[model samples]
Target: MKRIPLLLASLLLLAACTAPAPSTASTPAETPAAPVETPADPANAGDVHMLTNRYDGGQYTTCLVPSGSYCVSKIDYAAATAHSMCQIPGCQHTTSDCPVLSAGHLLVDGDTLWYPYIVHSDSEYAYALAAYTDDITPPAHPLFAVTHYQTDLVYSVNVLAADEEYLYFVGNSSYAFGGAGPNGAEAYLFSAEKSTGLQAQRLRLDTLLPGQNAYWTLSAAEGRSLYLQYSLFSDNTSGVYRYDLDTRQCSPLPQLTQNADTLGTPLCSPQVVYDLQQGSITAVDVPTGQSTLLTDTFPTGDSYTYAAASFRDGWVLSYSLWKEQDAFTHQFFRAPDGTLTELPQQMYCDARGTTPVNILDIQNGLVFLQYAYDTVPVSSYDYEGNPYTYDTYLPVYGIIPLQDLLAGSQNYRKLTFD
Candidate 1:
């Protein structure tokens, strides 16, 4: 824990008091870890900073933490009038009070914000993006915006991840999905820059692993180290592998995905893979290839619903439900003992409607949802060749109060990628 200076503490005391309480939650047997204390008016703690739904948007995948502000901007839109972005010392925006919207799955590198976007040109859709490194008092926002670059791409692009120096992404030129290789992507990994054209890298693993399938789903990034799901060809071998950007070395994680099927982002930590079903979790000690099973902490198998689990901080959150025909969803929080705490009411809106909320992950005391906003219209023509438009509806981020949800409160807050 960093020490709070006396003078700074004096200035921050009242301000911190006025700030929302630190989000915290504990189960019946274990004491929760203390909430992360945030500093007030933090400046320049620049740190380095995704999913398409069946297409690999990479949501819940992040490594950037705003160091400039003691508390980065997080919001709870439901209590908009009363909610405030976490800005006080000792404050951690892990609750419904902080909503973070990630526009087109944005990234934060130091003071700069980075993301991938599209612009229409002479005859095709050109891939481009912007970055905001300016940290001013009023935050007007532009060090740069929507600067175009030649990616030489013919299909849709997926913005993967960003580090302190480069924005990494993939260019897919394939149309239609098949059960095998190529999958439409022309390049597996391309490192883009603000000043130069996209530089295509063969993942440096192309020859070493020689995977024909070229399975590339970025699971998580920690520091300059990135964890990916790579199925190197040969015996159909597939596992989560860690690639160190600093060293250009790639190693396989056997325990991480040895028998894994449904996968979820590791959220804050990259050492573990949260199994979506079968009530089990696999964790890999990055240095050693040793793996461990944590199925004991999962819900005792239930016939009423099918469930998947996600681990964040100290809590393993899971949700269960029947098929679309069943028409309802249930959420649960598993304590260290696997005891399940079910949310009071059913979640989701019929599993097939204009649902503005999707569960991203769960903390000890809060549930994070991908909250949609800033409606960008997708241009098109209707049956008679008329302009038919609907919002692109990409979710940035949002937080739902656990108490409120468990208590049946319909209100929550949102955070935008500004």
Candidate 2:
């Protein structure tokens, strides 16, 4: 029996948020332009960002609270508070009995909150889809289920994106008895229609791009089209492709394709697809393929790599990875008018500047962050008697008002079960 290596799983997870861009372009040292006002289309913004999704006027996310269990929580931007979606009284929130806890990896679409859950039987395992709503109680049974024969296999099924008609997901199944060929695992893209009952249709990526072993991540969805980022394992090449749901056709975006190898995974808004390339943030118009330089003045040196970006409320948030320092460094917020404002480094680090913080998502005038807390140092030695010391920190989720973040305030409020 063989399983998907943890490193590969981790790389897939990282691809969901960021992509590494290695280039020969020289580093630039110039201050970013001052803040100005630019308008963005609210209708064009997609439903996905980091681990949270926006629907109607609310923001929803699944997070691990202090209770040692994952719980789905809703953020109230007006009140600047986050509380578990579960309303059951006296719930410890540490068991599947909690409705919100059970429905993991939530995707808020329209009036429904959809999630994927697994069912175990004596002979087979069922990967299923379930929905939750504010106006009604949680359903006891899943609306759809896909059965697998290998009961002991290791697998992951996640709901990636949803439109009015169908929900799209990626499923990876690791065979326990060598059924998945040499890789020992298989990846698939599936779609389940909202109106269809108990059905999951596997999509053919091979039909779009032939003879390539690749995995996909849904970067953005608009109307009848889906923007997918794919990495081909055969040649170690990566790029973005537009897949039309209506025509079942796929085409490469030439503007993005030109620098595909250097252009990392994109942060897509309705009107633009932004990528980090050659130490600068570049935006490509979705409709016209017109390229625009967002900012090139982000502090780029030999030690830093422009890591990732997220767009929300007309603001583009980006960060750089510090190679030598082993931390996420040089965080910035690019206003609509192209004004680049640097978030103080202290906000992401402790007094001694050891802990690393990740900017998870920005939405609804709020900034979601994940960092380690209550850390303790752990030291050990290798087989060659080499000394090594590392800190063990518990990861925690928190939020900061977007206005406060722009104004250089570190008023972080932890999303706790209490």
Candidate 3:
């Protein structure tokens, strides 16, 4: 199924008006899918600040900045504030030139950019998960693309996420959809290394869910184990499970918000869990599994239950107050010291209505928003004159230093791309 109705997006954002909080970690918080998603409010449709002429845009994300990082987040702005990333004398980072069409996932580790590339052979398109480093010549690479792994189901597969240790991709039929059993549905895990293109054993996990099957989303990896979550609750569990890359075993983590843990805004680490079931955020001792409640009154408001969001560097917890579909309306981060820092709140308008600002990556003092893009198609050609076409292109996406954004300086923290 061409999942994301818009340009084949994957993993639609999930939020609940209010999911019942379990009394403790063992309780399930399978959020009832928000009422049939309504078209974004017409009022939100009127905002042109983000899609205006002066700004550039790229697919925003909440995942880690390079790869194998955090999930995504969003915010709302009242007006289109002027902000640009740190630019050098001749640095080029705008998404204006659509070099190669992506088969829908990208990962940046250290200096190499890894992506599943789409190739047009005759009339059919094939895909390869490939990598390119800054060491290579620009505008043109050595091969049609560097291949790490080749697969026939490019269109059928979407990357759930990536991190330092592994490159992850999920396809409906690649293996995750191979079959089913009484224990649960079977999903596949295909991992690759970042430094060298090495393939790991393909793991099939029967994450028991109520429905047909369950797929794993890489939440975090540490020491010798990797953490995974289900697109839907897996193996009748809500929190992240520890998956040993070597043993392929799965175990539950009770301290993390297993009741409300989600891929959209997952903990992504073993250190913290946003368990609303206990109505508080807690810090976990990974080795001991002991948790200390960090904050009982996580930022909330009158019409919001203050859904617990993701954690940043295991030191801050992100929360968005949701009235209905307003996942990014108001946000605040809680630190280990029990201090709260609220970022600037702004709202944007589209032809539909006012909507929240799209926040991509949040960590270590930086916040990347899928903001600002030129009014052009994200299409371009490579050195070989191979052409590509994206439904929409991003001319600029804004990156704001968390401190400046909080201080109300509208300048992008500054960056340059080759």
Candidate 4:
């Protein structure tokens, strides 16, 4: 596993799409995944603006300069949008929640950024969204892109695929909602397009164990099929599956391992209750149902806490954390030939009371986050005097690739929503 450095790349302009400029904060800086080229459509032009709010305050938020600027918001939601911070010359103080996207999801569809605003309500699990925009404008209201499928379902989804063609997500259909029991839960796929909007399409399962389920990961392989790891929904068996959109079919790959969760958490938990080591990377052939175990030689001690893993370009990079006593660390690794290459630097602090960090999007060697800096349990300081704290959505960072991090690898799987 090769390490991926968590360093911010210098901002550069490419065509109309530019990298997210650096912010003023010393802690986790705000960085956009990649500059999205806005379509000439007027409806989407306003969608390119970047904005964020302070959870400590009301619904008030600050916007970044449309051209290219950085801003920081206070806990009270008092945001200061400047070309740069007062301290850093040629730098701006802008505010954005674009960097702190929740774990395992990215919203960039082509150039248009689909911001996911997770909705919490009685009968709806809607994600309020804003379209793509260029700068910070007042009344920074996001467009309400609601999901038509409403349920009290217990499904966990991470953004699996996003491109100009469609938006693909993997989640479980709950047995609780119009279900028989726990086994009633099944994996599903949802899609959306710039013209067609959002659509729900249930994937055909080769085996329905009712209790068997799998979460969508960022794992990419060749062909037009998306790879996944599935386990018995209950406390016993485990399996993996691959769904082919071209054929609208699915098949079981293999069972890497299973150590049932005692606490009954989602498929993304970092702990193990049954088998000390369960759930390694498994590749499946969508058409033939063949599969291979990528990493069987598990490491000792603890595995870094990463929300997910993906084979982008030619490398397998997993977002992980390694716990050393009281410190919680986060990093990315290049898993080539079963060997895990740890990134050169730690992406972010995985300490107690630290803000929730998520890798929202990765494109052209840059990572985007829907970051939120909240109250953590740890007390530490960065090089700057400011405590290592996430008061709120401060700024977004547009990272650049330090090295060919995805070197020595294979291609990722592909599928079409049309």
Top TM-score hit: 2
**lDDT, candidate 4, residue 305?**
34
lDDT digits (tens) for residues 169-284 of candidate 2: 65444331223334433344455556654234334333112232444566566666666554444444445556655545566664454333444443343223333434566665
Candidate 4 Cα outliers beyond 4 Å, as residue runs: 1-106, 121-123, 128-130, 135-149, 154-158, 162-164, 174-183, 202-222, 235-237, 255-418
Candidates in order have lDDT scores of: 0.38, 0.51, 0.39, 0.33
TM-scores, all models, native as reference: 0.50, 0.67, 0.51, 0.42
Q: What is the C-alpha lDDT profile of model 4 across 144-225, one tens digit per residue?
A: 3343365433332223354344455543444413434444444444444445553454342322444433333323323455
Model 2 — TM-score against the truth?
0.67
Error of 4 at 210 (Å): 6.9
Clash number by candidate, in order: 26, 0, 50, 66
Lowest lDDT 10-mer window, candidate 3? 46-55
Error of 3 at 61 (Å): 7.6
Candidate 4 displacement at residue 401 in angstroms: 9.2
Candidate 1 displacement at residue 357 in angstroms: 7.5
Angstrom error at residue 278, model 3: 6.5
